[model samples]
Target: MKYVILIHSNPDPWGHPTSRYTAEGRALSEEQHEQGDRAFDALLEEISASGELVTGEALADPASSTVHTWTPEGHLATDGPYAETKEQLAGFFLIDCASRQRAEELAAQFAGPGSVVELRPAMWSGGDDQ
Candidate 1:
């Protein structure tokens, strides 16, 4: 089974959990940064050993992102992100596992602190051999 994990933030439990989901800063604390790096590093090692990490990447800073709209002439460029939301796209990973349970386990193990990871099967647009 293969899966794609969409990394997004979720509500923090204590303050304003409903309308106000506390946003984890794009910049992590020194300890958080170290912990994240170590966790991801271990994840990568595991994936590599299992031969399941097909492809993956950490997105560039949202501040650097370009929000563009299509125009008749060409692709129109704009500044900033694609949407205004409490949560934002952080990064993603694609992996193949033995089953949904396994995928969920991996996702659960790697999910960032105070974040939501949506795991789903990859869709195929064309039939095999297409």
Candidate 2:
């Protein structure tokens, strides 16, 4: 089974590895932050060695995003994200794992203190659904 772990966090003061130093992340102590970093790195190493990690990437700040919509007249383009919310899609990890339970377990560890992690089964585009 293939699963995608979507990472959501506040876009302000953009930071990597699940926004450990951003908005809500500020509530945690430096030691806690370091622990989270170490844990994340270990998880990545474990998954990669097990051949479960397919790919992962961190997105740029939401301010750099562009929204495009189709209007009756033509196309409308605007700067910034499509949604006006505190949390936005920050990054994602695509993993090909054994089962849903295993994927969920991995997602639990991937989730940071101040970030929201969403795990969903990935669908194939070519009419071959799993």
Candidate 3:
């Protein structure tokens, strides 16, 4: 009944919105910022009303990503993420759902104009929190 919706970006696209933020684009102008706050409020209200959002967040840029892979040898460190192509995981949502269909319906509403959210059931270990 719980799922993680991984948001992915299209790599081949030249003007991907996720790729739009640069050093100069970090902070928006006053009007732009006001609009952003308004949008955030509306989005939060939508999520709360839907009953599909448990907790979610917009992630920091992928450039800040740190990768650690382990093998028999030990651990391997890398810069950024491990996306095969340009597409990368931008963010995610942890949700409790009644059915897969309902989850998918919720995903469709959340994706917006040019994004995809992959939903997968989560596995939590059964043990006392240490």
Candidate 4:
């Protein structure tokens, strides 16, 4: 099965890899931040070696995002994210795992104090016609 791990976080003073240096990131102790980084690195290495990691990437700031919506007149373009929530999608990891439980286990590693992690099965993965 293929799953996508969606990572969401507050975009104000956004920082990468669990918001290590931002004000929100500062909520954690320095030791906790370092530990998170090490854990993330270990997870990446493990998944890559197991051939479960298909691809992963971090997104640009929400301020650089553009939203497009279809309308009767034409396509409408907006300046920011599609949602008005405090947390916005910050990154994602696509993985080919053995089962939903296994995917969930991996997804848990991405969650932090304030970050939100979502795991969803991919209906259409790469090289699939149906």
Every model: Cα RMSD to truth = 6.9, 2.0, 6.9, 3.0
Per-residue lDDT tens digits for candidate 4, residues 1-107, read 88889998884577676576345677888898888889889999999999999999998888888899899999999999777987888999999999888999999
**Clash pairs detected, candidate 4:** none
- Report the C-alpha lDDT of model 1 over 1-130, residue by residue, as the tens digit: 6688877654443232111333553345667666767887898899889988888776654667888888889998888767687566666789988887888888886566566788878766662321
- By TM-score, is 1 or 2 better? 2
CA lDDT of each candidate?
Answer: 0.68, 0.85, 0.64, 0.84
TM-score for each of the candidates: 0.67, 0.89, 0.65, 0.88
Off by over 4 Å in 4: 21-24, 125-130
How would you encode candidate 3's per-residue C-alpha lDDT over 1-130 as one tens digit per residue? 7778887765332232442342222444657646655765676677678786789876765666888999899998898767666556777788878888877766765553345668777777873332
Error of 2 at 113 (Å): 1.9
lDDT for each residue of candidate 2 in 1-130, tens digit (9 for 90 to 100): 8999999887357777555656667778889888878888899999999999999999988888999999999999999887788888999999999889999999998777678899988997774354
Query: Model 1 Cα displacement at 80 (Å)?
Result: 2.5
Q: Which lDDT value does model 4 have at 65? A: 86
